[model samples]
Target: MIFDCLLTADAAWLGGRELAGPTAIGVREGEIGWIGPLPAAPDATHREHIEGVLLPGLIDYHVHAALIQPEKLLAAGVTTVMDLGWAPAEIWPLVERARHDPGLPRIHAAGPFLTAPGGYPSRQPWAPPLVAIEVDDPAAARRAVEALVAHRPATIKITLNSQAGPVVDDATLHAIVRAADAHGIPVTAHTQGSGQTRRAQLAGVRVLAHTPWTEILDDRLIADLARDTTIISTIDIHGWGEPSPDREIALQNLRRFHSAGGVVRYGTDLGNGPLPLGVNTREIAALTEAGLSPTEVLDAITGAPLRPGAPADVSVVPGDPIANPAVLGQAGAVLKGGQNVTDSDGGG
Candidate 1:
């Protein structure tokens, strides 16, 4: 196949193995057809060269798009994004509409945050009725899960923030988890305050929306979740404004979580406030400060900061890899669905 573009990077993060020498990746038919040393470019085809690095497109597992549109995500090097919480009736149809929108980040989302009656979002003015489900009983929890599954979410989001009003009981949480499991979907929860993480873990939650934000989880709690679940690092979002009590707790919790074998994922509560509309540098910095190396920090945003999927998208630093942790935040070439989406100039 004749490649429409040929990328040469001094270092290329090819599916997790960083190549040390010159490497060429060929894109044909909008997918990576070949990845090897540069052969002669097709005489009839045009080629674009990126001077720095090339890696897989970055993935943001949590973001709210109520404000930011989908196009910005692609321009920012995000090829796939998963919405943590949103209104099902409105967001579902919008997500369906976005399917035909070319080059938009592939969106896999949750219907809404399932919380207890008058939970966290219920008290916030911006928290609309459709943005979260307030379930106070096992039956209500089961109904919420069933309704959300019918809406067709990739996963179910539960809010276990006990500081705000009431959180769902273990029975109710288990009901939601069972209902979601019946449909083969996992549950991701926004857990905070005392025993919230433990409760979620015991109930078989697969992911935590934020690293515990009300207390430093003990070694036992960390090990429990590390053995089974993932914690989305919304570290930057927690410390957004002035230094507050919640931010301090979240920071401490994250430090402990990373210290344990617990997994971490890069997520910015993008639409929560004035956070960057795309891949967040603050988020990267926060994760790096929390103990992640340059590679591990990048991996958090890619697929396997904790698990495995593809290589975190590459960023070429002029200096040695060990010296330039900041370069991981620098956007580089992105490959999504194995196709080159942007070149050196940050355009296709």
Candidate 2:
């Protein structure tokens, strides 16, 4: 039997500082087929009166899938996540499984770190085998990216942690960016230690895995980065929930960048520490501290709106997140791709 599902909520957050009151949203074949005011809604085969503020599914811009259970993330309103660092051979299978399984959040992956022979993750004990490909020169860097094209990485990532062993040279970094551009892939970078953020930005890196925390950024440099790149906010990872100098430094840097019209994406460096499994309210609180208004914060976490033709991934929270940003902590009910995922305990 073919049936369409309708969900009615007291209010809905439509992103970009817009909110609609008393809404009716319908889903057909895993996509939003209809949406309007509750009084004007058409009949559906099944109707549910969800009792909460409705919003689009949240997205975690960075995570490592291998470290946690996928279902937990979906259960907590994180309908999508990006696997920023993992071997293509290992992460690709997980990505394929998530495409058809409601049990997992939709996955976007960047295969491995393109780094200098003895760079960052290569020496970190926690990084898995094959998690990084070392390149000695520009030719090797380009070739490594070309190889990843077959596996279809969502984007290319480079490591420039000068404090931890060697950094990828400028020629090699530019080669990585050029090759990724040839294939229409954007490049993300993890910058650490002194001057690395400036180096990454100058090299055409479109995304920063973590906001620069080691040193304060100059006004001109921060302005340029705001104009050219998107920064992933992994603010709480520096101290988990505790306050630290690094956390304070990053928050200040982000504060200025945001005021300068920078783009910030919410990404907890999940799996790096004892961070929250689902939506990290700590990260939310940190972003609030970094000067993002509740409305701007909503745009950062839930990158899209709950409109027609959008995937029917709904979030039912306690109150309007814009009014009370922390309400995103526990979604009372969630819909993933038009399916009411909260119906069960989400068991295997």
Candidate 3:
């Protein structure tokens, strides 16, 4: 069959992790249809030979779509993003837009922050009123989960930031986890303050929106977190391109977490500070500093393979990103669902 677009690259990040010699990837109907060595005589409706590393589009495990436009992410080779929190009314439209527009990074969002009344983000001036759904009890927590499930959130977001304000009680947190589990959705928590990380782990939170930074986690607690939860690395958000106590503590905690075999996903908490709209090299560098090997860091950003039937998203960089993770921030070309989102003349 004639492919819609055929991309030939000097090297392809096979399955988004392993690098393979000269390769060609064919896209059909917005999905990968084939991948193999480039043909000596190519045959396709459209063909582009790229002299760079071709990889599956990167996935930023945490972001706030309302805070940044999709074009910025696409240009940075990020084809998919998981938005942790926003009002359902505000975020759903963006998710819907992603469905119809390949130019936008595919967005999977948690509708709003499920928290106790007057908790965390609700008290933050930047957050809108509807961004936090205040659930006071187990019943209210379950109902809130149900309401969020109706919007088909990628996961349920619960706020457990005692340092900021009132946190959801243990019982209510468990109820939210149980309700989310019943619906086959995982629960991620924004854990803060003393013992909040332990509480989230014990309550069965599957992911932490940010690495716990208020206090250095004990080895035993770190082990528990490693066994039970994946932590989204938003360490850079604590520093915002500058060094501070929070950044140091978060880096220390994350290093311990990584040493204990914890799963770390790439994220920047983009909207919380004056962070770049695209892939933050600082976030990548921070992950490396936290003890992630070069390959592991790439795996965190790539997330999955670019196999047949997967979304036709690809990022071509001028050089090997595994050698210098920062190179990822400057993509030479980016494609989402077989369509070119950005391309630079000099192979940026």
Best by lDDT: 2
Q: Work out the TM-score per prediction.
A: 0.84, 0.96, 0.94
- The TM-score measured for candidate 1 stands at 0.84
Tens digits of per-residue lDDT for model 1 on 1-348? 666656566656544434345666665545555666555434226565667655556778888766577667765677778888887766787677555454566777897888888887767788766788889899998888888877789889988877777887778999999999999999998887788888888999989888777777887887777777888888777657447677677777777777877788889878887787776777777787778776776677777321123322333333333345455456655555444446323333
Q: Per TM-score, what order, best first?
A: 2, 3, 1
CA RMSD of all predictions: 3.9, 1.8, 2.5
Worst 10 residues of 1 by lDDT: 305-314
Clashes by residue pair, model 2? none
Model 2 off-target regions past 4 Å?
1-3, 16-18, 345-348
Please write out the lDDT profile of model 3 over residues 1-348, one tens digit for every residue.
Answer: 888888888887774445788898888898988888876424679998877899889999999999877667877889899999998778999999888876688899998999899998898878886998999999999889888888888999988889889998899999999999999999999988999989999999989999888999999999998887899999888868799898999999899988999899999887777889888999999999999987888888988766888988998888887777888888878888887777532112
Kindly list the per-residue Cα lDDT of model 2 for residues 255-278, writing each as its tens digit. Answer: 999999999999997878899899
What is residue 246's positional error in candidate 3, in angstroms? 1.2
Ranked candidates, highest lDDT first: 2, 3, 1
Please tell me which model should have the higher TM-score, number 1 or number 2: 2
